[model samples]
Target chain A: MKLDLYKEHAAEYKAVKKPIFVNAAPAQYLAVDGQGEPGGECFEQCVGALYAMAFTIKMTLKAKGQDYAVSKLEALWYPPDGGADFETAPKSEWRWKLMIRTPDFVGKQDLREAVKALQRRGKNANAGQVTLEKLHEGECVQMLHVGPYEQLCETITAMLAFAEANQRRQHGLHHEVYLSDPRRVPPERLKTLLRQPVRKA
Target chain B: MRDRTRHSYEQRILRVLTHIQQHLDGPLELDALAGLACFSPYHFHRVFTGMIGEGLMEHVRRLRLERAAQRLKQSRRAIADIALEAGYGSHEAFTRAFRERFGAAPSAFRRRHAPLPVPDGRAVHYTPDQVIRFSPKRSSRSMSVAIRTIRPQRVAFVRHVGPYDAVGEAWERLMARAAPMGLLGESCQFIGVCYDDPEITPPERIRYDACIAVSGPIRPRRDLGVQVIAGGDYAVTTHFGPYQRLGRTYARLCGPWAARSGRELRAAPSFEVYLNSPEGTEPGDLLTDIYLPLMPAPGTE
Candidate 1:
């Protein structure tokens, strides 16, 4: 049977109408960082390379009878250097870390070997850029935003207000957990979990 | 930094973490781990700190102590033995380190049988079993438990030996085997008897039996087996989430809740009764009643 992380941790991946606090659990991810807009060439290359490595590792583990469902794509968005804020930062100055969660059984050896194999096949030149890292974003305020990406600020504003009323303040990078693929799901129906790590005021 | 250079650094640090996890009981000199990552000890420490957000030795010490904490709670091993296994030279040294990390002495911690100390939020810790990602303990989750008596049940079951996540095949086979034999009745209760705690037992060695309660005559077949569910006084609770997360409810039911409820645990294996099907219900709405057997009265046996 295939292990589904979303199903295993239903509360963590659930979609919520209003902003709510959650203790986001620790997880391992295959991450690639870049500076650009979401759909830029570098971003696309990194996403493709990350998935290539993910599939390679997944297949290898599946052969060993450790199969799992590939989790959703997620990203951490940061403003460019020099004290620029995300709201006003130019699209070119956006720094993002694209990530896909990997199962615990996937080790550094699996990733290193996957890179070597992909390199040998001359597929995904950016394969080596994908690295394994564990992230623990504890005590976050999150809400499900359903619609176009351009309309996210409205949700963020409402979320910020909710947090302020609850005596919490954002303390980490802007994080997004995509539950639906943009290409597959309609923009009106696309579901994205907007998360912001927060701490008591 | 170039992507290649960044990847190299991240990969080396990951390798070091893996090495540390595999050899926590053995010698974990910074020089040895650095050599494994193909770097000088000096450079390796800085790189590891830069990537993992903790000093290398600090990380190792925390992992060793955390592992010791797990052993303290899960087994009856002597503190000295646990200290030795955690790479501490002496019990005193282990206790001091454990106190600093967990804020309580090892014996006191064991006496209380409290949950492990809150992790440092670094996402790097020690696990006795497989190297899985960390999740917050479900001890704080609210639970409504009821003590009730359950009648013994006769059932047909299919045994499964693997990770709990991979029990679908057994269920599929059981359904197929039971459907044609006129055993799929509206009153039949789908049950699962879990024989091992995944946290304590290795994933591959864990045992589970997918069963369906049957009242009529049934014979043991090649693929299916018949058994009696020895039911008695059970502390029952409803788990309102995905079946994959049933372990959390079990942990709560058996851990703090059981320890405080003043009920002695029985030797019988615990089982679950599905309240609803997962076919159409939302994952969050799926419910399962977990029944943990309790010891009978002194003379009732």
Candidate 2:
């Protein structure tokens, strides 16, 4: 059986429940950087383009004797203006990068091939913007936000307070690992793993 | 005492401590311990208490309870099982005893712990390793903190408890055995993995491992265990002063760097890499690198 890294090592994939402190192992990902307001059709298209290329590579590798489950959608958000009020940032000014965890067998060459293959099918996948990369998140404060996307500001504030109490502050881009599919789940019931990378402040 | 007599005494006590730590879940009767110490059963209690600063039974109970509390915080072990593991015969007995020591029920303590202090903090005499640094205006801006990836390492280590100042002894013992194996050199890395926050956990109960990274075939003697230190991205800050003021450097990291960095702490244990030993080096010249584990922020991938 193909090993499920998340299930076998539960701590590495610790769910956002409370403000849990964690250190993450380095993992590979298929990433696409973008600039826009999320929850709009454009962002959804970007997510679709990412998944389309991701699944193409997944299937391509499956045929080569490496079968694995696709990871949940994850995104990094930040303001290009270096502003503190990211919650109320204008949609046009918000910068983001959408990603999915990719296996080691899937490399930069494979990502390029996946993008080309999607184009060959007459679909304009945002394959040009996607890249395969490795990310190492050392220690973090994580929690599950299970409500409307708009309510995330309050939860994030609480998380920031928790980090401040423990002597941590924001360091990298704001990360949200989407655990629930917004299409199937109601906005009020959406579940997202909200994480803020921090350093000793 | 003569050198031979002192050595024997140290060896025998170490043997007893090794046996107790290795088999914490097993019976540690006073008679059996006295036999191991090669002391008369009648006089063992007094001798052990005098030497170790606690009664044998009291020491065993404390160790077991402390181990149980550790498991409760980090693992999903059953309370009844943990109670048994702590050497209590019944749940009620364990509850009463735990409450008496920790000032909370076992479950409550697990949820929001205020750990009980170890009975004796004076295991080894030491010049202090850490002290609160004041007057940040001078040193705060001087610390240069950086984030980078660290590769995984395989190392052999010996655990130590008591004050951070006493951790020097654990390093002493590890090097004693490791040096003969030709494990000390420029190629090898020294790391100290401290698992507890001194501000929270008692100084006497704080856990630390003095480790040396090694590869290839290496024999691990009793009390020396081998494990891998998981390496990844870390926020590293170097302290260029006496070891006592290192906490002030950490405050510089935690208060300024961590609070404003947009990064969060990872679950992995942060560690220190002693760039230079105290020997032949002035206190003002010693360099120690403190590595704090980190992760990306919530809204990032």
DockQ comparisons of all candidates to the true complex: 0.01, 0.01
lDDT of each: 0.76, 0.70
Clashing pairs in 1: none
Which candidate number maximizes lDDT?
Answer: 1
lDDT of 2 by residue, B44-142 (tens): 443354445545566677667777777777788999999988888999999998888767888998888555444344442111122211111122355
Q: Each model's interface RMSD (Å)?
A: 19.7, 25.4
lDDT of 1: 0.76
**Deviating ranges (above 4 Å) for candidate 2:** A3-5, A80-84, B1-301
lDDT string for model 1 (B1-301, tens) is 2344445555655677778888887777766786887654323443455445455667787888888999899899999999998788888998999999888999999999577767666467786664635221224556799999878899999999999999987886786566444354433578999876454457999899999887767888888999999968988999888998775566566544554565556656788898765643568767899888877744668
What does each candidate score in C-alpha RMSD? 25.2, 26.0
Q: Per-residue alpha-carbon lDDT of model 2 for A21-63, expressed as tens digits?
A: 7777787888888777786766767776776676567656654
Among these predictions, the greatest TM-score belongs to 1
